[model samples]
Target: MLLFQKLYSRIYKYSKMLFLLQIIVIVLTFISLDHEAIAELPYTSVVLPVHKHTDASKPLYSAEVMTSFIDWQYMRENFLIDIDATIIWHDCSLLWNKNQGDCPTNSCNYPVTCEEYPCTDIRTSSSYKNRYCPPKTNWSTLPVWGLCTCPVNVVNPVTVSCVQVSLNYDNFRFNESNGRNVYTGWDDVYPHAACAPSSSLQSFPANVTGVLALSSSPYALAGYLHKPLKRVLGLCLPSTLSTPGVLFYGSTPYYLLPHSDVDVRSYLSYTPLIKHQNSFGYFIGVNSIVIKKRAVNIPTNATTKISTTEPYTILRTDIYNPVVRRFLKVTKRIPPAKPFPPFGVCFSTSTKGTQVGLRVPDIEFSFPDGKQWTTSTANSIKQVTKDVACLALVDGGAASEPAIIIGTFQMEDNFLVLDLEKSAFGFSSSLLRKKTSCSNFNLTLVNSYV
Candidate 1:
């Protein structure tokens, strides 16, 4: 009985050890299965939100003003000014030709003809003859010199005289050395005032016509001083002219000084008679004052006149580096999609059943490796249907099975359905592994076949 009890205890101990070993093996097997399942998770190529750099700084100038000036300059310099004048004349001629004679008449297709005859005097016997001639039309006349008359006659020559009068009047002077006596008449034997009562304190000369020659006592003044005078007096004097005061006299000798500060100031106050002359004296210290006055009228909001009122959205994608070089063709089954949240897809293409490819419409694009993505079908392909299918290529030996990670499908007329879920990762990973090993595996469609 003692030996049997000892044997039973040993058996129990061995059994417990074996059970623990089995549990450990089961746990290890489970961990390995879990790992394999995780490894098999398919990884699909997905386009995620990529942040792009944007320029949010304000523009250097107002866009509206710049555009307006650009358009104005273009029209003025290119389109409007460069128009052919002959074309305008041709158009005018056509319009005149359409209005035949008086108006459009069903009876005549051409203009009526008119004849001219010179009338004979009753004293002489003369005859008139009818001549076939077209109507007196003056369509070749150009309006020059504000006249439509033809320039065929030059009988009376027209003369245009241009007289240039110098504003300088140095000969006229007032001598204040003698008693206040005004002597302004040049044609009379003696100085005469137009106003009577020579001492009435104010005197003006009367109307005196006819040319008269003058001989000055001083031979030094020959040409200009002794000039022939033809005066027409009694003309109304300007309002700016004023009679000299009782204390003033016309004989005051106002000598012209070389550099008189007072004269310079007075001359500057008067309007300049000569152009391109230094109105301010050479040594006059002149200073410019710039008054910055703020504009009182503020510009309102700019309103652009747009012909089309409909709004549109544009999608532009610039891919610098592509995954493959050769052409690739891919077809993915897209779900129903919407228009919001603007998005696009990028992929490569291939031909081999085991190689990925891009498929769109009638074209199939394939890409091998080490090439840029310049082949696009956005502009070429049109009328993309909802729930469309597309495919992309990976590498030459990569699996050709379509892994749908990005898709767009229309649910309604305006609503679109999109599926961006990465559920095919496990299957894709397993396929890639199997393909690398050159193992034969079923590549049937996942969801459809399953």
Candidate 2:
């Protein structure tokens, strides 16, 4: 009996040791697989929060640069953004140099040589006029005015002036997002852009260092980052200064959290995004304008375009007159106030206010395919004072080619996706009506996919 007991104890101990060895092998395999998965993961998308601020004169939308060239401490510095701009540019005069005692070791700015790819390629664009001039070997030669030494000269969309600047390439960082949560920073791509003098930034808001172009041009911000983004761009313009909206590069189900599993794209209505050969602006075909569900005749020849530079929509007199007449007729019951400059009609808001500004009638834009893009009273009317509100539409006097230019005010709180692949402009009219706003995107959520 003692011999049998000893044999049993020995067998049991061996079996126990073998079981632990199997557990160790399984755990080692799992760890190896986890490391490989992490190594295989490459960043797919870029996201930035679009900040809104009012200068002395008007509101401006901007984003900060996340790059190795700029000191992280000065991260508050930003770039003004224009959806119609054809190229990205920065004012280089006041940049921190490495020789400066306060400059960070990672921060340094330098221009690319004229012999480089982008600078060489700049000569090919007819718009640039081949203004690229290499640096003179001799110092005695008279400096040529309006010539680009190492970069190129391009027209500034905001000021409508020409800017001569140095060309630079840098790794621009963007925050990665899985729609539900922001993951990590991605900086693998190095895109080249122009750097102009600080004088080029006149009239821009203070602390704005550059301009980011979101136009359809091949050299625009979206094009340079297209490989990872898949030629998709999404923008949500915030209505207030306190809450910032978001700008993203990539395809989307656009999960703005708190509304779990809900995709904002599903709420969007798509229209064919038309590109004009002579213009960089985004245009769409509008069949007519309807006031209070009544169709107002719009000139068939007139074009409609969207703009972020313009604060309010501008309508050519021909289109404006008829629409305003119809609107005035509909709201004649409310007492008409004195005319405000630019705004042709005004009303006294002695009546109790509602969610959509004095409960005014909704204005609808009927499209070519019988689809409609409607704006509630919240967008159509602006309350300038406590007791007064004005019709936000401005008359552009008859010559404007685009009979209607929809501006940023009307676009606020709306989700817009410019899908280059589909060549479609998708819009979600007003997120406010859906009990959310552009500011609803949750930045603090921990992504399980991460």
Candidate 3:
């Protein structure tokens, strides 16, 4: 009787163990199924707001972007994004924490193969050597490089040094959008492969933990979108740090909310994008420069690059002298104030103010397509102090490659689009001219919709 009772007890214990194991398998399968479902979502495009971090503690000179990342447990965080048009890699320094509790995500499993889209192109790129040069740090610590697990190298725009790190596939969520408007309440999840620095980043804002690469590379942040999405990147920079702007990836007809009748795309003027042999920066052919409708003699080799890093438009000395001279000639009646350190020309703020900006002559650039992009006082004049305002143009030593660089201050409240598929650039001279601004995109409406 004692032997029979012991056999029954063993049988019951084994049955319970088998049931528990089955439950675990079912749960694991469900998680896999959930991720697969998200991957197959039909959304084709995404949009994100670009804001200046209002928090004084995290003062970043560059524009701030917002993005969401999801973990295995489905927790998400809107990480601060830095826009980099010159670099190719999307970097995330937020995962530097060694503690698993901080991330709570599945560890990186997929090793970026050299044969992959970006890796292959990066290795063969003209700028590959200069762009991906590793820092002069410890090289012995690098892992044995191989096809299954080689690290992807990237240059830090801030430090101008490079670091190699492995790529990890993380779930990212974005508000899906049609070209014109966004679907405010919907959150679409997509897997994006990003490299996380093994160490903390230096010289970056405290809250800025990631970079959104807007370069023309196939691996730009928008390039990660599903195959069906159009390869277009649109930007509207806000005039003030307190107001938010918008960044979108998709076909155009972008509408700033509350004014849905007007498509910002309608304001865009097209110019062919000039491709540089070894540079990732967006270059455009500038046929001529005109100040106040009077043409300035610019070198035939002169080109213009659109940049977010430079705060003011930079002109080579030769170009600067001629352009500045012409501008002064046009506005000679306006009394010149003490020259600002970086800016050669300055005027008293006592000058009459227009709705757009301080009354000043316009600077225009004629493109190869025979079209011109005009900048009036709104973009050309920067008020330094209550007493003085300066021309927003800087001198970029005569030897600089791209003769003119259009910077952030000049881009404010202007709509710019880079259509990769078309290899074309589009510009909306100024949104304020249309009685609207980049900040007109109503975040309040977005919040209510959410």
**Highest TM-score model number:** 2
Q: What are the RMSD figures for all models against the true structure?
A: 54.3, 10.7, 10.8
Best-to-worst order by TM-score is: 2, 3, 1
Indicate which candidate wins on lDDT: 2
Q: After superposition, how far is residue 34 of candidate 2 from its true place, in Å?
A: 15
Over the stretch 231-295, how does candidate 3's per-residue lDDT look in tens digits?
88888878777777877777746778667788888899999888887666688888788887788
- lDDT by residue for model 2 over 115-165, one digit each (tens)? 557666664555445223332221111133322345466555455566666
| Per-residue error (Å), model 3, residue 71 | 8.0
Clashes within 3 Å, all models in order: 57, 0, 0
Predictions in order: lDDT? 0.18, 0.73, 0.66
Cα TM-score per model? 0.14, 0.79, 0.75
Question: What pairs collide in candidate 2?
Answer: none
lDDT of 1 at 408: 10
Per-residue lDDT of 313 in model 2: 90
